[model samples]
Target: MTQERISLFVDHIGPFDAQKIGVLRGKANSGLELLNGHNIEVVQGFACEFDRLERFGFSPGAKIGSDFGDLDMALVQITRSKVETKLLVAQAWDATRVGGRIVVDGQKTDGIESIYKALRKLGIEPDTLVKSHGRIFWFERDETRPFADWLEPKLKMPDGFATAPGVFSAEKLDKGSLALIAALPPLAGHGADIGAGWGFLSRAALGHEKVTKLDLIEAEIAALDAARVNIIDERANFEWADVTKTSGRFYDFIIANPPFHTERTANTDLGVAFLTTAARNLKPKGQFYCVANRHLPYEVVLNELFRNVAEIGGTSAFKVFQAAQPRRL
Candidate 1:
C-alpha cells in the first residue's frame, strides 16, 4: 500500500511496539516498512516517552496531539488502569474510519482480557492472537458508539483549578506540596517548577514579588493545559516538556515534588532524575526546594547533586529539603 493510503497509531512507543505494529500491518498485507513514510501518529502524554519515540524516528505527525480523531487505523498499547484502558479503546474506536481496524495489545496481567470483554459490549468482536504473555486483538470499525462519557472530564481542583484523570493528584491538592510551600523562603529572579501539576506550586511561588518570572514545566499535556487556565500571570510560562531532557541554564531557583512511582511500582530513579535535572538547570549559587515522602531516600540524591542540602521543614508523612550551590558535574 502507498503511504497516502495508510495511517498508523502507536501509543507509548517502546522496544516491543515496532514488532506489534509490523504484525498488525502484515495481517492486512500492507507491505509497509517502519520508515515507509506512512502517516504514523504516536500519542503519548509523557515527555520522556515521547522523546523515546523520537529516537525511534516517530517524532509525532503534526505537533503533539492527544486526540486521535483523524486516523485510518490505530494500535493502542493498553495500560494497567481500567479507566485509562477504557478511554484508549474509546478514542481508538472513534478515530478509526469505517472499515479501518483498531488493534490493541497488552499483557494479561494488565487486564487485557477485561478490555476484550468491554470491546464485545461495543459490538466489536476482534480477531485475537495470543503470545508473549499477552494478547493482540483487532476489529474493523463499522458502527460507532457514543463514548463521550469515557473522555476525561475537567474536574475542579482546589482554588478553582482544573484537572483531569491520568494527571497526578487529580482529586485534590497534594499535602506534601502544601508543606513545601509553607516552608519555602522568598525566591528571586526567574524560576521553574519542574513537575508543576495544575500550577499549584507555581502559583504559590508568584505570591512573592521577588519572583520576577516562573515556568511551569510539566510532562502531561492535560495538566499543562489546565495550568494555563489556573496561572494567569504573564510571568508564568507553560512548557509541555520532560524535566530530565529539558535544557538551558535559565532559572535562578527550581522547585518540584517529583513523581516516584510508575504504575503501582516504586521507582526512586524517577525522582533522582528530577533532582539531577533541577541541579543542571539552575544557575551557580541558585537554590532548589522540593518535598518528598518521608520514607523516600532522596537525601542521598540531593547531596550528590548540590553543594549543601538541608531539611527545611517536615511533617510526619512529608519532608521538605532546601539545596543550595548546585555542584557542577
Candidate 2:
C-alpha cells in the first residue's frame, strides 16, 4: 500500500536546498523563525518593505529581487490579494528544482483554501494544515503543472504601456497621473520620476522638448523590467532603488506618484519620505511635482523641505502638489 504524504509541522519539511532556501515577499517571516541559522535567501520587490526588513535585522543569507531563480525549495507567505498570490505561486513553481517543494501559508481571509484548490487543478495535491486563523500547505515538484501561464508576461495596459501583475496601476494609466501630466509646467534638462511604475510618467516627462534626460526610479523589479521595454528612448534611465535612502544627487526636476500605503495600513510616512528624498535629490532651484490621495498629510513635509509649495491641480479624490527651491537643511 502507498503511504500518505502530508505533514502538519514545519519540521516535517523534506530535503531542500542545503545551500539556500528562498522566502518570497515575506513580510512577517512567520515560518522562517524555525529555519534560523540555516541559509535563507529572501526575495522581496517592494523597496519600503525591504527597508523595514533590513532595519529589523532579518539578516537573510542572501537577498534578491523579484526573480527567485532556481532553488531546492521555496516558502511563500501568501499575499493579501488573489492576483498577487497567484503571481508568487507561479514564481515559486518556476524557481524550484524538480523534486523540490513549495510551501505556502496564509490566513483564511487571504484565500489560502482557494489557492490550495487551484494547485490541485494543476495536477499537484498539497498537504495542508489549518491553524491560528490561517492555513499551511506544501506540495512536491511536479512536471505536469503548467505554471507559465500564471506569469502573465508583458501584459499591455490601457495606456499602451507594458506592465505586469503585482505592480502599481497595472491595469491602466493612473487618472491622477494623467491630470498631473497635464498640469506639469515646462521642465528642462535631466529629470527623474520617483516611484516610477512601468515608466508611464517618465515617458510623458520626455514630451517637454527641453527635458534632455529622464530617470525612472522604482523599487519593484517586475515594474522596472516592464519599464525597460516600454520606455525605449535613449534619454530614459532606469534604476531599482529605495527612494528614501537615495540622496546627494541633483536633478532639474522630479515627478512622483508616491505610494501611500504599505500592506493594508495607510502610511503617510511613505509619501513623506518620497517628498524628502525628492528635495534631497533635486538642485536648489529644481522643481518637484507629485500626486497623492487628497487626505494624505504630505504638505507639511513638502513645505518643510522646499522654499515654495503650491497646489497646482487635482481632482476631488487626488491632489497634485508642486514644490521648488529645495531648502538646504
Candidate 3:
C-alpha cells in the first residue's frame, strides 16, 4: 500500500529537473527511479531498508546531524509517529534551499490529514494530491521557515534511558523485555542482544558478573544511537544491522525481544526470522532467550530449531522462552 502511494506520488510529480534532491525517511521501493536522471541523496535509517536500497544500486546514507542542506528539492516520507512525521517534514524544509520545492507523502492512516491541516495552521497552503488512501503535498520553501522550530525538538527520556520518537517502547521500558530480563540466568562468555532497542535488555544482561562480552544488534539507527548513550561499557559492542539477513558472527548465547510489526500490521514472519537467525548464529551448545506476545506462534519455530525449549517466565500477556541445543543445519 505504501509502495503504491509512493509510486503514484512520484508519477504525478513527473521527472525531477533539480540539480540535487534530498529524500528523508524514504523506503527501498519509494519509486526513486522516477528521478533517476537527477543527483539524489537518500537518508534511510532502518538497516533492512538501507541495505535493500544499497543492493538496488542507490547510495543511501544515514541522516547525521543537520546534513544534506541546500538541496534543490526534498522529498519527505511520513512515518507512523506524528512527532517523527513532523520531524521529517522539518528536515525536508531544512535541507531544501529557499524557494526550492518540499514534497511530502503519507498514508491517511499515518496522520497525513492532520499534518496537512497543521501546515495550513502555519499559514502555508500546499499543493495537494489525494490518492490511494493517501496524500502527496508540495510547497516551496519560503524565507519565513515556519517549521524551523520542529527541526530539533527535544525528547524526554523515560527512566533516564535515552530514546527517540518512532522507536519501539520509546516512552517507557517494555514489559515483555523486563519479563525476559527477569527470566535470564547467570551469563558467561560472549552473547548478543538482537533487536536491542534502547539497550534495556543489554544493560540488564551486562549485570551478570560472568558475562565477558555482549553485542547489541539493532536495525534502526535512532534506536542504536540511544542504546549507545544508554550502555557505555567496554564489554558492549554495537552494530547497525538486520539480524535476519546478516549476522556474521556466532555467539555463546543470544537474547532477543524481536519485533513482530511492520508499520501498523502484525507480521509473525518477522519474529520467525529472528528465531531462525538466533538458531543459526548460536554456538553448538548455545542457549537462546526471547520474549514475545503470548499469542504469537513462535514455539513451532523454536521447537524446530532447538532440541530443548521451555517457557521460563512471563506475565499473562507475554511469554518468555528459553531454547538450548540448537540443531546444526
Candidate 4:
C-alpha cells in the first residue's frame, strides 16, 4: 500500500483572530515538517499568511505570500465560530486543479453544517462527511472561479461607535460597558481597553484627562480596524491580538467588558484567561476593572487569580468587578 499524501493544513483561517498561541502552533509544526519531505510549498493566509508563519511560531522562516501555487489538497479547522465557509470554498474552487480536494472542519455549534450545505449552493457539495464533535466535509474543487463576499451585507453600526457584523455588542450600546464608563473612577495614567470591540471602552478610556495613552487590544480584524478611525489621537495604539494570549508592557489602568458566552454556551469565562493575561500586562499595583452579567461566578475566577477582587457596582442585569495585581516581591 502506498502512503497517503500529506495535505496543507491550518488550525484556523479567520480575519481578526488574535489567536497566535493556541492549537495553531501544533498544526503549523506538523504541516511544515511534512511539507519539507514533499516538493509542495504551502501558502497559509491569503495576503499576510507568510508574515505570520514565523511571527507566531507557525513556520521558522516564511515570508508573506501574495500568490497561490498549484495545490493538491488543503485542510482548515475552526472552533466554535462559523466563518464565511463559502469564501473558502470559492477560493479553493478557483485555486485548486480539477482533481484537488478542499477539507473544512468546524464544530456543529459553530455552523459547520450550514457551511457544508452552502457548498451545494456553489456546486461543490462534500463527497466525504465525518461527524463527531463537529463535521468534516471534503469535496473535489473545480479550478478557480469568482466568488461573492458573504460578509458584505452584515454591517454593524451605532452613533459614535465603530462596529462590524458578528462582533459582540456591535448593534447597540452595551449595558455593561456603559455602566463601567459611568462607574469608572476619575481615571488617570496610561491605560488600555482589553478586547475593545468597536472602540467603545477605548474611546471612553482615551477621553479621560488622566490617561496619557490608550492602548486598544482587539482580536477581530474588522473591529480592530474600526477602532483605528475612532481613536485618532497621538496617545492611541491599536493592536490585533487575542487578549487572552497577548503580551506587552504594563499599564496603570485596564478596563473591559469581557466576553462570558459564545455559541449558546453560558459562563465559559474564557475571560478568566484574559483577566490573568491582562494581569501580567499591567504594572505592579495596576488597577483592573470589567463588567459582566449578573449570574456569572467571575468572583471565584478573579479571587483565585488576582490579589484582590471587589464588586464596585451592579444593576439588575450586570455587575462590575474592580481588581488589582499585587506589588511584586
TM-score of each: 0.81, 0.84, 0.95, 0.70
- Model 3, span 28-96: residue lDDT tens: 776777677889899899998998889888988876446688889998888898878898888788778
Cα lDDT of model 1 by residue, 1-329, tens digit: 22212222222222222211211112112213332444555666666666655665564431224454556667666776666667777777677677676777776777888988877876667887666566767777777575566766445566667775567877778899999999999899999999997888999999889998998999877789878988889999898888788877658999999999875689999899999999999888789999999999999989988989999997999999999888888
Off by over 4 Å in 1: 1-38, 61-70, 152-159
Taking every candidate in turn, the Cα RMSD to the unseen true structure, in Å, is 6.6, 5.0, 1.8, 7.3
> All models: lDDT?
0.74, 0.78, 0.88, 0.62
Measured on C-alpha atoms, candidate 3 has an lDDT of: 0.88
Better of 2 and 4 by lDDT: 2
Give the residue spans of candidate 2 off by over 4 A.
1-8, 11-20, 26-33, 36-39, 48-71, 108-111, 121-124, 146-148, 153-156
Estimate, for each residue in 1-329, the C-alpha lDDT of model 4 and write its tens digit. 00021231232221221111111111343334433433343333211333455564444212113344345655544433344344444544455556666666666776777777776776665754444546666666554453556534444467756665456776788888888888788778888888887798888777888788888887665677778876788988887666777766778988988887654776555777777766777888789988988887788877776788888987889998888874342
Off by more than 4 A, model 4 = 1-57, 60-65, 68-70, 94-99, 143-146, 149-153, 160-167, 170-173, 220-222, 242-248, 261-269, 283-285, 301-309, 324-329
Strongest candidate by TM-score: 3
TM-score of 2: 0.84
How much is 134 displaced in model 1, in angstroms? 3.0
